[model samples]
Target: MVETSHIYYGTIVHTLSVKNLEIIQQAVLVVSNGIIVKLDRNVKDIDAYISSASCTNYVLHRLGEHEFLIPGLVDTHAHAPQYVFAGSGMDLPLMDWLNTYTFPSESKFKDEQYAQDAYAKTVHRFLRNGTTTCSWFATIHLAACKRLVDTIHDLGQRAYVGKVNMDQNSPDYYVEASTQASLDDTRLFIDYTKAKAGHDRLITPVVTPRFAVSCSTPLMRGLADLAKEYRLPIQSHLCENPDEIKFACSLFPDCKNYTDIYQQHGLLGPDTYMAHCVHMTDDEINLLATTQTGVAHCANSNFSLQSGVCDVQRLLSHGIKVGLGTDVAGGFSPSILDAIRSGFWASKMKKVIERDMHGNSDYVCLQPSELLFLATLGGAQVLGLQDLIGNFVEGKAFDALWIDADRGNVDLIGDLTIFQKLEKFLFNGSADNILHVYVQGRRVSGVPDDENDLASSGDTLNHGVALDHTTKPSI
Candidate 1:
């Protein structure tokens, strides 16, 4: 008979209740294989169990006085093909930028070697950033989409990889030949990914249709059919910028708004995730809420491109699920921590502007705890993986990060409580401050030199990677 291994004596910080902002702490967690089996405040006769268990390999890691453990971030919106253009394209609005910069850069992914290199770099960067799960948009190139899934599988990260579909109103170099061809390729990509079963865990295929402007009615309808057939999630941009919204309204004159276009095609549902919903109207918000669709509030991308601030407080009031998205190239940072800080500041700016306009201070502002929830549990819910991954609850995957807050150390400052420290870390801490990152209870990032030296001295510690993990799978 085999006995289960337990991980005890750690300060676990995760959502204790979804409705409350309370985080559970000072807990004991037991993991078998990759999934968490139990979480308790006290384990009866832990010492005896440790000694008697046959398959048990108990590892007790005492968190440093300044260190805190939190669930790993999940990025709901990011473009794996846009890694090459990360800091460029800051000056153009959504449409012009998509054409001049994004389209041109993404076309390079058609080259298998280029796709491999860029996808590898992007996946590693995500791990180093403490992002264990990502919903990524791949380029129109089917091979490029495969490259992304392959790279993510090798990196041991849970991900949703989409083969972007666009048949019209796109640059000739980047557009697909026809709507049928686009649907066919999407089906192929989905079938191919499904065939590669356990090589990757939680690798779901998403139906991606670029956006309203780029997709014709037929293209969207066909993609929606595929979505229903595959029972997969759908992700795309919506109401990201004023110009894009205007163009979409013009293209789909019969539809009430950008969200309506998706709704008319049966694309609005629980598994649908729309990015940068900055200009959605009340009607659209209600529709999103009724359909149980999720929104990815990409604050950095919206502000960077001068897209108006998203009414996140309003969305939350409507009971809409909102998650943080880095939006990669558009956002200029792969770090979801940056996204969280941007979300907090963006909400504050919205609150101030609202107060000034109405001469009333009654408007609710986003709190730090809300922003943290958006970055973690909220994102998990948005991606439809809440049951399996989000929060540090027992039975969920043990994807967590150990942050060092010691001021003397470069990775973290040693002066804050777990909550305050997490807020400060999101606002100011760099990748250097992430002491260690764990995905599925396995240490994927390398340990720091200080941690290694301490381990030799019988002190257990964890440290993060200096650069992204670069190990690629043999194809």
Candidate 2:
């Protein structure tokens, strides 16, 4: 008979089901070959799995008094090239921000060396921020996109890296050569990443077009074809700002609305992810629900740009799948915890605004658990990886984080229940409270006595000081 190692003992807080938040106190989870085998609340009979002598090779990590484990966060939208530009474009609105700040900053990624440095720092920062999986947009440069993928693999993080395709209506400096060039480059990037096997199962290529304003009709169609051919996932922005919507309407005059533009081009599906639906109409919401398309709610960016709040409750009520995104640079904070808080606040603000606008209170406020679900399982579903990575199911991948809530003590004193402690962490915790990060059952961050050392390591290549602050254009 073969002997299988079992890792038992810990307080497992796994989202066993989306409908209910299951907390298994004093639980045992068995992992083998990087996948979870069994998770039981009580498994005292160790001899049932293996003999006493055979249990020597098994490793056990105890959960401290105030420590609890949760699934590793998944950030749905971020720009790998825009990490340096974070906190720089505070005042700028969407259009001018892109032209004067975002484009100029992204142009630097043409240099492979600069890209390597920026991507490595971004990935490391993500791990520190408890983001185990992210959907990243790389600059138009194919080499730069490849560099981002390589860095993700080296860091053992799961991600979808895309070579942004935009041939028309972008700034002259950042535009692609042509539609064919964009298609060819995308194919090359997909092939290159797909060819490199045995690195990590999490890294994959996604098809990303800048958006309706930047991507020509032909380019969008070609990318869609490629997506179908390769069975690749698609991600891009949609109706994020009013001005963006107006421009898209003018650019494609025949389309009924912002969502219609993508729908006409066959871009709406289960595997498609659209960021920032703050300005989407009821018809657009229905379309998203009908097609089962996903929306990434970038609350921080929406508020920072004054783009208006997303009707998150409305979207959910309409049966649209929603996830949280930092929308970094625009969002300022890399921590998805910030995104959660912003998600809550944004929904409340939206309710207030809607009540005032309609002279009646008919809207519902979002719940904290629902918001957390959006950040985790909702994000996994949006990225088309829910079965593999989202919830803490018995057979799911063991990707999670151990958060230390000892620092969040308030005057309340005394002991707190496991769920209460978790609520406190959700409401009050920051990235600093994250003591450990695990991806696929491997400890990737939070080593003892090395936090300061890890924080001091700067980017491998300096992209130079970020540009000065400017007000972004209203979307």
Candidate 3:
């Protein structure tokens, strides 16, 4: 068993809302059994606070002057197999890109060893970049998908893993045998994930339908029924590009629009989230708000793939939940920090276009705190994990990253305020600035004890235990 209680004296930064950022300087935080138990601001005596907790054997970590804790990033969309080709295939658009680069590359995952190596590197890279939670899209191969789950479990990262489902429009070599086979394999994948880590709620299996263009009507309906039956979250692509939207509407003529295709199949609900609604109609936005479904704003992928810029402000104004996603391979980056930068640019580009073309001079750009909220709490609301891991609250889990603003790529020369330091880290920092990454009190990644090296030796020393391997949840 591992030590269950930990205390830290440092500066704590978290978002109170989209535009409001709360920074507590010289605070004491108490985390026991992976949950934050106490947070006292303006703490003058760390020793007195520790005594008040009545803890003698608990570990107390002190933060440096340049270091502060922020909530871990939540990636709403990413592809596990595609991380191998993240920087490649940027020249092609959505449909041709999928045919040439995506399908062929994903098909190679039929080899279990290839999937294992690729998934390990991908998950490790995300954790190293301080992404504690992710929603991953695996290939159609069930065994390879299961291996992806095993990798995340072994690495001690929180994630929602989905075995991609594509039966109708995919290539012959990569597609499932039939609609029935697709549904059966999806059921099997859900059962495996639940039986493995159901109690911990760390790793969950999501129902993925690939997209409307790739899945048949019968297959989509079946997947929706499975989601309802298992009470699992559903994720898929929606109205990303003009060509993609055109094709999806053509596929289902009976439906009114691209969003209606999924809605007609009983897939739109509070538990479902669709990625890249770049070309959504006003009616469709209203439909999403009515159904309480969320959207994952993948600005990096959209910009790289030549997809249109998504108006996140419009979505937020309409009461639709929104979050950030580093749609790797399509996005060309795995870091949610990169996502935040790209998303900010995407919003500004939209504002500029509106001002120049539509004679709208009052368009507003997204603020830094708004972008931060999209990366953290907004993502939590998207994946239904808001109450557990979004912010630094008394009852929330301690999922956070220790960022050193004075570290590599970010040189703090003069004295700066607390918010100024945060802005520097957000705009100018890289992975080198992340000193330590923690998920549920487990240090998944961090800087090495030796200044010249990384924390490689102890990276896997204390991983979150799988419920399938142990009778009780490991603390």
Candidate 4:
């Protein structure tokens, strides 16, 4: 029989698609070397299967009745540097907010020690919130960006970290020096990240141009070329606010609209993802779909900063991929769960507005399964990690969160249906309810390390040693 590393038996919940929430009860999942090998359900005799497989050197973790395993949440867009001021500075529009708070806070990252201190907190907070994968925007300072990459790597979280590029804009205190300097620093940052990652794709570098408003035409073109040269994915903002849009268009009068500017610069492609396409026209949406560029719907940021509400339903109807983004300081939270809640409210707000306009509730509301998909599978598709994550398919990496619905934030007062339990967790659950967070089959976050967990489990882990540096006890 094959020697497996670990086997988990319990209820498993995950999205099969945007509309399908598959729940498997009494399931046995096999993992070897951090990759799922097999998932068997409704086993009549657990002992028989284990003996038949001749499984030796395996850790059997059994979940409680109130506990279930779900795919880890994915955050498609966020600014790691902006996390320092996440809860403050929400009384202004996009452009004003950037100048007043965002720019000044990001500029301080030029100090290496400060970057390290702030970045550690940001990454740890996201991990505790069950975000196994995140696509992060680091400041333009090359050294600070490199420090962000190192912090994520050490924490064992899967991520796409980008060194922001901006060669033009109003603020002289925070903008890049020139197009050449931005391109050179970006190349160095990309090379540094690639070398640091070695054989592991856990951390990747993205080309971030901030937005067309701040980036020069030459800088945008150079970034497009750099993305092609490195075969890396690109991320940036698009049509987030009205004033920002007008200014962006004024900067490039030859272009028809905001989306056209990106397409003209060879910046729109399948390998690229844009955030907050709240004000995109039908023609622009078509351009994105034609180019196969993914969109990150940052509902929390939209609501917090008073940016226009994005119709995620519209994006999906147009066959354009959509994902959830916290957008950090603008969103006022680092948790993807907050993104899910904000997205739900935004969809409901759309329904209300439509009813007010037409006297009937014809707007579609996002179902729980769909919200789960947006937070997980949809984000994976946006990051081009659909093949590796977003679900519990065989031969895929084991990135998951163990949900204890009966503890912490959620309360099981009486007999409830499985769907009710799931809904409660989605609406009310917090990090306290996530008993364990695993990335690539390794426990990256969970309960605190204690003597009980360090105790010998079996032949595999022994002598009160930890599973790894990032591993914590899950009870």
Candidate 5:
């Protein structure tokens, strides 16, 4: 009965920690100016409560039996430009795949207009899939990178955009002129992105090093220094493939190992998160744990490119922060739900490999709750956004997804527990199940703008006839 702009009454599926999933029934959540102002649980009578609390000037939305609210999904790592050809090429391995599909596609971003069009579609698709926050890696073209930042700003997705740096070990067409020029462009990109953000935390500029093979030592060091000066997060690849690792290690013999290359360059710290640690040693793992660096477990990309499976459990046990990422074209699917399914199977495959191939029957895969955590809270943690978003905590921005389990491909033939409905949505549901997507109290996707009548929602304040608490709310 609180006076608010938006009031949601229904079941809430939220995560308190990595393994703690809470299903709160009959909850009353009040949202004002994109902030969750109040959450009251186990309300016995809605009409009596409205009469008692002097609630007015609010839109009350009574959720359906099968509908629920979950925190918006987060993608810790993705290539924004690679969405152009995400599902076309997948037969080759890591290095060959990069040469065949990745480079040529990325090089096309030199044209600013083309980058804008592609970036718009990419952000739209990710938003439709319920990803409210994403960390994006753009190609080395500064002009196109700037356009990408503008596109994301217009679309209203919380994101971290990085202009890539590759001064050496790249194709002649796509390589930068010099390390100095690359650093200069990176600094400008950072400044432009910061100005574009203008006090809003929606868009952040990330320092991106494509990988060890592409960037020179000086360029890496310069990027590290820029990150330190700007206090931004850094994203890059690490130990993804054996051949790639060998070539990377060979380039810097003075360093002890592949992970050491970044550590010595001052890029391994709490602000950095490396993608795909599929092949890592104990010393390398220790280095990451010691430095408090984060890891992005791209399971779909690992299987797609024939990279060995990463022991995510082992990394978690070592006290290293871990999250999930859809490596875009390498992952073949942009949906975080797909990442969750692949992560579940990846652990099973690891246990099987140990039991049959190595004669050791000890292996643990990722559970549904853990996968849920990795997609939402853990991804936020990896990007150092754990405090602001990732949960339905009061005072946090109301970034959430309105899920209708009965509206999707899932079929509940009989009565089921509340957790089962969530499982069905996670395992068998698609974007169609999502009725509305809201970021900061504004609906960004789902439920077209013209379909919902806002005046009717305000009827309680004006005419006081209907309560306007519809079963299928478009909030």
Candidate 6:
């Protein structure tokens, strides 16, 4: 009745919280502009309700027999430039990997055309893989970082783009000139991103100090100030590997430990999220909890880089927010679904390691529903976007994925439930299964466009064609 713009009739699955996964079948979701206005479940007759409400002038997307809608995957931590070398550099550790593959690959973004080409492909891959929201770590090259922002803006995936800050310990070929230089470039990057991102929801500028190892004290302090002044989110790596932690501790001798370095510099807060906190001490964990910082649990990267297993259960027990990350190149995938599957196995590995240490494990194995939450709402919480795009709550942006199992790589057998189908898609289904990727009510990715999507007069559907008023909503 409020002048809906789009109507979806199908099953919708999403997590209300960590343990509250909801599956609403035979539902009708209405979108006005880009926000979800109504979600009525168990609609006995969609056509009757449409006529009763007199809802006209809208596009209709009715799911097929084997289709369903899901909240799009949220990738809390990823390196946009590193996506060029995503499946490489696994043999080396974090510190060495940065030098061998990460730095060299990222440094190439200094070329603007190279950056755009790489970023376009990277953003497209993430979108087609159903990562509608991603917190991206772009290189320190200011122009390249700006290019990354423009590419994501043009592509339409919500993102947090950070021009990485590192004034010391980086290779001569890639490191910033000086602390002031790093700060100056970072200020420019933030300002540029803000100017480019006229609105607050789509693209946010983030403060990214690659890690304590590469950042100097003054540089860290300056970056923190920028975050406070702009009210932007902060992201960085922390306690990811033993050797890396050792180097960071050696750099800050006065601090109690590696985590204290950030706390001492005003870099840890609710607006901050650190990736791969695998080797954190109890005190460090407590510090994050007290600071209300979030953690991006990158299990595949941790295992690939020989970084220790992160006890997500331990982090959750302390009430520290946690989400999943691909940590591309190190983890070797851009697909958040891969992150989900890897997260599942990583949690199981934690259970084994805990049992081996304590003889009897009290660790709660991360359930499928909980892992699903980590990929969606939990990741949104990490990026400080929980109220915006995580789930199908009223007034939230409609970032979603349309799953077409029949069109995908799945070979469905007899009588499988929708929930079961989702599990299979999570563990076994590829990007082919995700037929459509939507962000803020706009179709951003997937296979060829649907001919049935009929837009109305005075409506601006990004990819939908306008239809006449006589064209009624059809099944």
Evaluate all candidate structures by whole-model CA lDDT and list the values in order: 0.79, 0.79, 0.87, 0.87, 0.86, 0.86
What residue runs in model 6 are displaced by over 4 Å at the alpha carbon? 1-4, 448-475
lDDT per residue (tens digit) for residues 121-203 in model 1: 88888878888889999989988898888888766677888999988898889899998899889999999887754653568
Better of 2 and 6 by lDDT: 6
Number of clashing residue pairs, candidate 2: 12
Off by over 4 Å in 2: 1-8, 16-19, 42-56, 197-199, 358-362, 408-412, 447-475
lDDT over C-alpha atoms for residue 3 of model 4: 44
Tens-place lDDT digits, model 3, residues 1-475: 5544566778989987787888999987878767898888998876665555543446666777888899999999999999999998899899999999999999999999999999999998999888999999999999999999999988879999999999888899999998899999999999999887767778999999999998998999999999999999999999999999999898899999999999999999999999999998899999999999999999999999999899999999999999899998899999999999999999899989988998876778898888889999999999999999878989999999888898888989898988899989999988888877888877778765432233333221211211111222211
Q: Which is better, 1 or 6, measured by TM-score?
A: 6
Indicate the worst ten consecutive residues by lDDT in candidate 2. 458-467
* Structural similarity to truth (TM-score) of each candidate: 0.90, 0.90, 0.94, 0.94, 0.93, 0.94
State each candidate's clash count. Answer: 13, 12, 0, 0, 0, 0
**Residue 77, candidate 1: alpha-carbon lDDT:** 96
List pairs with backbone clashes in candidate 3: none
Which residue pairs clash within candidate 4? none
lDDT string, candidate 6, 38-156, tens digits? 89999977768676675456666677667888998999999999888887668888888888888888889889999999998898889889999999999989999999999998878
Which window of 10 residues has the lowest lDDT sum in candidate 4? 466-475
